[model samples]
Target: MKPYPFSAIVGHDQLRLALLLCAVRPEIGGALIRGEKGTAKSTAVRGLAALLSEATGSDAGLVEMPLGATEDRVIGSLDLQRVLRDGEHAFSPGLLARAHGGVLYVDEVNLLHDHLVDVLLDAAAMGRVHIERDGISHSHEARFVLIGTMNPEEGELRPQLLDRFGLTVDVHASRDVDVRVQVIRQRMAYEADPEGFAERYADADAELARRIAAARALVDDVVLPDNELRRIAALCAAFDVDGMRADLVVARTAVAHAAWRGADTVGEEDIRVAAELALPHRRRRDPFDDPGIDRDQLDEALARAGADPDPDPDPDPPGGGASTEAEHDAPQQNPAQKGKPQAPTTRPSAPPSATFRTRALRVPGVG
Candidate 1:
């Protein structure tokens, strides 16, 4: 299928940003796309593949691995004929090998078998795959930028596998009438004349490619300041996130944003946007909750960071500390306190009951 040019995608700023981040830092892990059908998820990935192909100077385009593919197709298998006839091992490179240094797009990823998912996850996590089947063994560098698309209506991915993704984005159908009209118009034009439509966006695509290359060069130089790092930490904590992955994603994504904008240092706005995108899925409680990243907490963090240098050490409370006092005085009991009274009395009851039952059972005629 022909992918619509990356620049021609109408309005998926978040998805675009996440994909860009993955391209900048493949170490940040892959991206997961969740949306309904016909939302252009696959189209966006293919467009990204085209953009990345240009930037990376690789002729091997993005490798598309369909769902429910066999293990032999994904990680390669031995050549049975060669082994039987000549006693020589021959290996065929699989999708992962072909995807080296490029993008690996998996459509309908949620429908893939658990074992195949594990294989992909292992390759992604280790940046290589090892084969030891059929008395043949070898390892190949199989690194690639993994991009997966799934429709939530079909099913949900296991949390373990979901957490492996560094970024998750949701794409919704277009709502604006004018934007929809534009989308339809563009599609019709492309269908009428694919090459001409592609040519029209050629310059735009080239400019984007230049920006991606420049951003890649600048990614290592982008600095995340102490204040921004602390803000990211506080945001992760406020969201009750589980691991250190959230913090790393926020920091890296913020730096990528800075690089993409041609800045050397990350700013508060960069961290804010990154936190919104990176921390929502990391939250352990209520992944779909509104204000999932604790907007109030983030706002307070930003205010503290941007406040005047010599301001008052203590600011006046809105209600003169009454709310703070009430919160302090609220009655509560620790688990230790609640269980102290019941610990000692239940230890002596079992032996006496046993003795009485034993004596009564010796006289069996009484009942």
Candidate 2:
């Protein structure tokens, strides 16, 4: 099956960059792409998987974590069939095993079970799974890039697990009429001829893959200066990020971004970009406490310390992904404005991947 080409996908430059940074440096953890439904969040991820596979000839595919999955299927469990047939204790690998050395993508992740979220957090952080159940000791290397997509309307991820993701990029639908038309035309074109449409973008995709490969080679040499490192610490301090993990991941992501841009050493611009990706999810979302890191302070520090502002400070979607699914799925037809002839926009529902898992566990505080 042909995937929507990564290069062909429109808008969300920061999202694309975050995906690349994760690919180049898996140590940076995975990216959590939050957006409303039909914003091409899943499409971008699928396209990324295809592009990466073609670019690196990686046999491992993106492992989809379907909502119907159980604790046994996701983590691992005793192989009952093997134990019964062979009369010997055996362990059966789960989705995590299959996702080894690949991408583990979870759609509508915010709606998933808390326990499931907990399991993922442990494995992602450790880069391995150590399962000890029923006197069956098991441990193997299980490292993969974890990509999760969610529509905020369903719900928000717990602040604890939310911080686990290395980078977070919001995805929003294009408001520009021209861009929207281009998106639709391209979608129709691809649907008509997936192969031919992919063929058209093949060169661009290949070039991007090559660029990623080159970045991987140079990531080791991308180093940060002492003063710049201090700035990163200062920024984190201003934000009052929970732990050193945030401080450390920012540095790691910045270095990878520098390498992605083919720069030998890290730069201020790289740090600025890294902050945007890493800080949002990490900073304490306090409704009351407004910290003193104002734009002027940030600008003054940048001026005195010579930090370059983002070349494209604002992305195309201007507003990032609409977190709530209601934005796209729920169209409120205002009844007050009668007979204005506003055509209701309807999007085809995606085939049910699993029996609506979100509704399974309700009663918020209950297990």
Candidate 3:
């Protein structure tokens, strides 16, 4: 059956963006999709693979990791049957090898064996797999985008494992009646005529794929300003996250966001969007703790890092092209609004006043 077109997937803006970011910049690590069943999670993953295939003009297939797969089957093993027949042991590539240069998707990943999960995460982070079994040892590149879906009600991954994912998004069925109706109508239409339905969205998928390719090519050249670096670090620190992984993930995610926006430099909006995607899961102090950062808190953190949490939009460049930080920061000159004075913007480094003893301002407890 034809995979549902990614553009046709409805009402999953964050999920779509997270998957695209990982596709454009795999170094940002893979995304973990947490949501209920029947929320189009699996469909979205398959569609992303198809979209990537269209975008790169290659067979970037999607390899599903079965729930009951063994370590040998997942990583690789010796071809015992071939050895018996030929009297020579040979390496047999596994799912990891088969998924090279594409996407390795694990459904119900939380239910998979902990050790298997470790193996997958290890390969994802290191971009290589090692096999040391049946008196034969070998290593090969296993660089592939890792995407996993899980229902939080079934179980939760250990914090150590959870922290490995570069980005995550929570998805839920839409509550709006109109959206629900549209989803059902689309599903029925696709089921009735899969080929025709796919053809209708092919152009859109191709256009998005081209954009993704362009972003991937430009991501390396996209500048990460010093102020943006400070903002990323301060945001992670303010959330009181466990370690430095959050900081690094936020920085990489911000750069990817800049490239996605066709911007030469990372802006405050890019950093903010990066934080929203990368920081929520990392900030959970306990399994039961609600996962999210307060908007005011995020703004304060940005302010502390010398950024305008809510800066004005960049003016359109003459003759039409990507916008630069210089253009965004430069004062605007619109004759229509020239008579009115614009509000002053400030971006100050970590001021001493911003740093004060919390205890000093605490009121005496009446309890």
lDDT of 2 by residue, 1-367 (tens): 6898999988789899999898888788789998878998888888777766655677776889988789989979999998889988898999998877778899999988988988887787788899988879999777777899998778889888888889998778989999999999999999999999999999999999898888888999887988778778777777778989888888999999999999988888888888888887777756555422345654555555455343453323446655455476876767896779778889999897866555555688777
**Global CA lDDT computed for model 1:** 0.82
Clashing pairs in 3: none
- List ranges where model 3 is wrong by over 4 Å: 286-288, 307-367
Whole-model Cα lDDT per candidate?
0.82, 0.83, 0.88
State how far residue 248 of model 2 sits from its true place (Å): 1.3
Model 1: residues with Cα > 4 Å off, grouped in runs: 287-367
Worst 10 residues of 1 by lDDT: 352-361
Rank candidates by TM-score, best first.
Answer: 3, 2, 1
State the TM-score for model 3. 0.81
lDDT of 1 by residue, 259-357 (tens): 889999999888887877776667776555642356787787667645525434444477666555567789776876885664554554545444444
On residues 87-178, what C-alpha lDDT tens digit does candidate 3 reach at each position? 99899999999888788999999999999999998898889998887799899998788999999999899888899999989999999999
Clashing pairs in 2: 152-323, 153-324, 171-321
- Number of the top candidate by TM-score? 3
Off by over 4 Å in 2: 285-367
